[model samples]
Target: MTRQAISSYKQELLDTARTLRQQIRAGEFTSTTSGLASGLMQGNIVILTADWAQDFLHFCQLNPVSCPLIAMSRPGEPLLPELGKDIDIRSDVPEYNLFVDGELTQTRTDIADLWNDQMVTFVLGCSFSFEEALQRAGLAIRNIDLGRNVSMYDSSLATTPSSRFHGNTVVTMRPFSPADAIRAIQVTTRLPKAHGAPVHIGRPDLIGIDDLATPQYGDSVPVHDDEIPVFWACGVTPQVAIRNAKPPICITHVPGKMLVTDKLNDELAIL
Candidate 1:
């Protein structure tokens, strides 16, 4: 894309994010943010108590590819001014998953009632950001075309541990022709914060994923015969870690329902 075209795309993204966030806050839009607000950064939300924050922070550091920590709020603070001037951790996300004792207990649209001074919010870079980059590069994302959530799998690849946080890496897969996959690698490589590039390509067995049609999380889209299945380390990896940690209370954005941020995707990209 040319410099002028890039600037125009970014402005459109900013406008979309601003409008979408208002709807999200009003409880009017409560679905997947995937393929919406293109060119803006979408984040995976993780909220925990101060007691578990340190260990969780360590978990992010140890598994940077899957859990790249982009912004965090101080203990007891629900506001993350770094991500957006209006971002409120307790209400910005479209949907939230509440976990207790390593098991998912409930899913909520807003966590205002659960917000406490003891709580801390962690925003991790999401693959959705790079999906936009792929689309801009003229690559077709099957999930987007199918109008469903991206396919996610629990891989055999274990992440480095940090205290009680340890689990297999979770990945998001996108099918592409061999030629497009190469272009995808080149495009995504520029965005490290977005889990930059595929970790595994062509073979699902190597990653211990038995079936592409049946994903461990999210809806599955068809992979054409000529296309290769490409996988990238996913932000949901921390949810697995949180489950292993078994903290007293944990909160995260529902998989596919991310927190749309004001930051531009290009801001997280490298030359």
Candidate 2:
């Protein structure tokens, strides 16, 4: 595409992202953010009090693949201007999982009521940010085609510990023919912020996933006989860490849902 054409396309994507965020903030769109705002970056959110923020930040540093830190907000600061104009962390995500002492108490559309002076928001890079690239490379995304959330599993693979945070890594799975899988890997390797490449390919059993039909999170997607399941480190890994750490209060985006940002996905790509 020519520069002018590409610029127009990207502006459209930015407009879509901003509209989606507004809908989310207004409690109008609360579904999984799998296929919307194509060509833009999406993020996984984790909000914690100042007391637990340092440890969680360290945890992200230790496990860069699962928790690629993109943007972080200061305590009690709802705005993340670095991500986009008027990006309100508290109300931008479609759905928020409220955790109390390591247990999910409820799902909320907005967290403005819970936001306090000590709360800090952490935005992690999400694999969803790379889906548009895969499609651009002529690969079909099964989960998006199926119009369901991507299947996610809790792998026995462990993340390196940091202070009080420790837990198994969570991964997102997508099925592709061997040839397409290779191309998919090549396409995603450029976006380290989007978990880079598949952590595991082929057999699910090797990764401690007993059955793909029943994912620990998100919707189940079938793996065709000719295709293999490709797993990438997921941003949800922090939820497992939160469970282990048992912070007094924590908030995160729902499993399949995420926060859409105005940044173009290719802007973060490594050429």
Candidate 3:
């Protein structure tokens, strides 16, 4: 536990997005948002100075699978009207990672003091938005059941480069039986905003992942002999790009922790 883990996930999981945001805004819930706000869309957050916003936007556009852009705020402005009526980019997420010169310098509950006229917040659609759909399709999400953050890895596959951002894609892994994975794919394919479907299936090594026990981000979950590993493009891909681009300062949601938005997942899902 890097920071203290929140209790009552089961009870709290049913909280509305606004309620959850209030808790997050108040600094009461600082753990992962993996299982909260069921049926609603969650977003991956990235805040950068005006100087780097355009290039980062280009990076996201180049790799839509990993960085599905949903909403963005004007420089120095903290409100994202598209996400929620009262969504404040400065304090709505549970935790934030502050990067200085491409290195993570600190994690904070809020970034109000750091917000400036040059800051721009970009919200990318998060894969957690599709978990309820997976459940509706009868697929089990392992990490949620195990009370842990999902496993994430850096693949050998490189992202399409932008003017100043280039790095390998970051992926989140979920293990499912052959039958369930097919259903999972079908269910998620309708929600392109949620990173869509699995990018790779089966052998982890083929994608350059050496082990399942250790991950680049989040907790590693168990993969049974009966199941295969399924990978999806993750929003954290931008964080990797940030490292390569070396911006003076950047603030992003800590991995697995996200901005739980007012919008419903069904609104973003294609029929």
Task: Quote each prediction's TM-score.
Answer: 0.96, 0.98, 0.94
- Compare candidates 2 and 3 on lDDT and give the better one: 2
Root mean square deviation (Cα) for candidate 2: 0.9
Model 1 TM-score on a 0 to 1 scale: 0.96
Would you list the C-alpha lDDT of every candidate in the order shown? 0.91, 0.93, 0.90
Model 1 clash pairs are 76-117
Q: Please give, for residues 5-121, the per-residue lDDT of candidate 3 as tens digits.
A: 433442244357778889899999999999878887899999999989999999888888899999988888899987777899999999999999999999999999998899999
Best by TM-score: 2
Across 56-129, the per-residue lDDT of candidate 1 in tens digits comes to 89989988999988998888998878888788878789989999998999998889999888998899999999
lDDT of 2 by residue, 1-271 (tens): 9999988988888888888888999999999999899888899999999999999999999999999999989899999998899798888999999999999999989888898999999999999999989999999999999999999999999999998999999999999999999999999999999999999998888989999999999999888899999999999999999999999999999998999998989888998
Q: Total backbone clashes of model 3?
A: 0
- Displacement of residue 187 (Cα, Å) in model 2 is 0.8
Winning candidate number (lDDT): 2
Indicate the worst ten consecutive residues by lDDT in candidate 2: 10-19
